[model samples]
Target: MDVALQALTVLAAIALGVRTKGLTVGLWGAAGVLVLVWVFGLPPGSVPTSAIFVIFAVVTAAGAMQAAGGIDYLVGIAQRVIRAHPNQVTFIAPYVAWLFATGAGTGFVYYSILPVIYEVAYGNKVRPERPMAIAPTASQMGITSSPVSSAMAIMVGLMAPLGFEITNILSIVLPSTAIAIGAAAFVQNKIGKPLDRDPVYQARLAAGEVTAPEPVDIGVASASAKRSTWIFGTGILLILAFGIFEGLRPVIPGADGPEPLAMTTMIQIIMLIVALVILLWCRTRSADVPRAQVFRSGMSAIIALWGVSWLANTFIAANEDSIVEGLGGIADNAPIFIAVALFIVAALTTSQSSATIAIIPIGITLGLEPWQLTAMWMAVIGLYTFPINGSQLATIELDATGSTRISRFVIYHSFTIGMLVMAVVSVLVGLGIGGIFYG
Candidate 1:
């Protein structure tokens, strides 16, 4: 009865989400599942870690940045770049995708840039679907190995018990970042040209499809006109140095590389602080939004992801054995299956951190190299680049005119196809790659 009720509750949550597209309700669904399983003693673990502190910190940091006018500034800069080079739209698209993925999480990254994407589609007669697909898909590419990503952090934590070393991880997994990025660009070129030829896309561009963007009210930050570009560069250098060393820490025989060396959260905190200091020193202006409003934006961004992640973790924790068995069957012979499974999980959960927490531990038990597991991580990142992501939601709020037309399915499937292509690549080279990593 407990198991049945749990399953029913999970189904209800999913059904509700599908019907309303309400992330909040989906979270409730996860909570219900947790109640059924945890309170009823269905799953094996004692209790899933709430990870509330992590979520709170991420939200606070985001809110602080918004208060400082960071996101508005990003949007302004992105808009200008897109407007300046409509022709390079395909080429520059990845950078735009990467930027959103970096801090905002892939789904929210998709949400944040929707207006820009829609406008670019309108201006260039670009098939918004393909570029839309490309952008979101690209955003997911980062998550598998991004030091800053919460999902990556979760993996770091989950595997900490196993003494997984970061240096060992880098040699095996870091290469995938380059591969994933290249794969996204390659797929975009292949898929994007076809989208351009679609009659609907052509017709829409001919109709002058205008996504009514919110008026840009922010002050312009001269990215080029700054002595502190050097300071900015220095800060970035420091952050990277910190991150690289942190990534290497898991492999160190003893804990002496840098005192408190493993705390990468500190590295990012410092990075954000330095970014602010340099921006101020350079007198870099922010977008027109007030500081308070900016903080609100950041709070929105963080919560956009935080709620979904917390809920999903709760659900997976409740139905873990079932979830694990369902997913684990393919984990070994079906790396591709694991990848696809994560995409759906990410899409359903609408947050990679949640999906990663739900899935990766099971994946590890099913047998994965921490390195190859990294590739699997990329698959999840790609999945969340769907329209359901937070930034995509935020972007929708920007364009009241509804110029952005790709439905949730289109964004999800485009990324799905990208995942398939990567799977194909892995299959073709599976033996070679597998031998190198797992053997």
Candidate 2:
């Protein structure tokens, strides 16, 4: 009875957070933690200080890059790429979205390119929904694969202690997610009616509600923009190099032996330097960094991760013995249940970092191998199960042609098929890659 009540408290907090959206999720999670500690008498768990600081550093650099026009420069390049392949916008657009998210280390960068995607598709008389719906899903999937993203930061922090390096995680995820995006795009191309045959779009066209897409004017990249983007790209490359070749890292004498600097600490140091370099060399004002969209979104993720992860960790710590006893046998026999749990939690939270911080630890405790858990990491894209995600809503609003839409049945929205396909394919591919690498 006590355990059941504690579980109910955690669920109720997550439900309220999802209902309210935005920063309130953190507030509600903190409230749940208070109740658990004061009312239920459970001890508080350790705060996720390492993950929080890594997110802060990475977001700082990304925000600095955005303030210095790096994101605009990248978006201009994406615009040209999509426009060049008008007929294949469905195939090209999602990959562009994924690339932007992976490079910028945040999916919010997908917003600037959304209108461009709509223009390219609509101008070609293709269904805007075909590309727009799946683009956001692809962007979200990119987060799991991004080295500097909050989800990846938390994942690295968790798995590094178990002998899994950043390279191993990325090796499994990057190829799997990239392949999954392609599979989803292929599936999405076959969905929906042709734009000319679509009644809603035709009706909108006849009524003059839909206008011809205006030419996208992604302004030329100024010197400042080009410099900042190159600097940021250099930073990402350096991080990847250090991760792939641990010998490149500085070694310090320790109590036992010389220890190479930890990747978590290295990431923080490098990103902080990157932010400072962009600010000084690119002539960007420090005041504008905090105001950047990526910074705002990243801060919200930190808050949500802090409260929710603390609550979850505390609850799990308090009931570790019981939880392991109850779920261990099932997990050992049917490991897919662990993936399903990750998917459901991700869908409920709608924040990849929060979902990761909250659930991955549980999987670890259930005696699952790090490779097994890593293989299932892409399952977090289930956040798209509902159409309430910001990117999904933005895509719907951006399509003036009325081709993209949510069905009366909420679950049957435009993004559903692509999201489902991506989830299934990525996990299967990840399992195969993980087996080769770690089996």
- Top candidate (lDDT): 2
CA deviation > 4 Å runs, candidate 2 = 253-255
TM-scores vs. true structure, each candidate: 0.66, 0.98
Give the local distance difference test score of model 2. 0.90
RMSD of each: 6.3, 1.1
Per residue, candidate 1 scores C-alpha lDDT tens digits across 386-412 of 556544455444433342344555654
Candidate 2 TM-score over all chains jointly: 0.98
- Cα error of candidate 2 at position 134, Å: 0.8
Alpha-carbon lDDT, every model: 0.51, 0.90
Error of 1 at 52 (Å): 4.2
The lDDT of model 1 is: 0.51
Q: Write the per-residue lDDT of candidate 2 for residues 254-358, one digit (tens) a residue.
A: 777999988888899999999999999999999999999989989998888888888899899999999999999998898777678888888998888878888
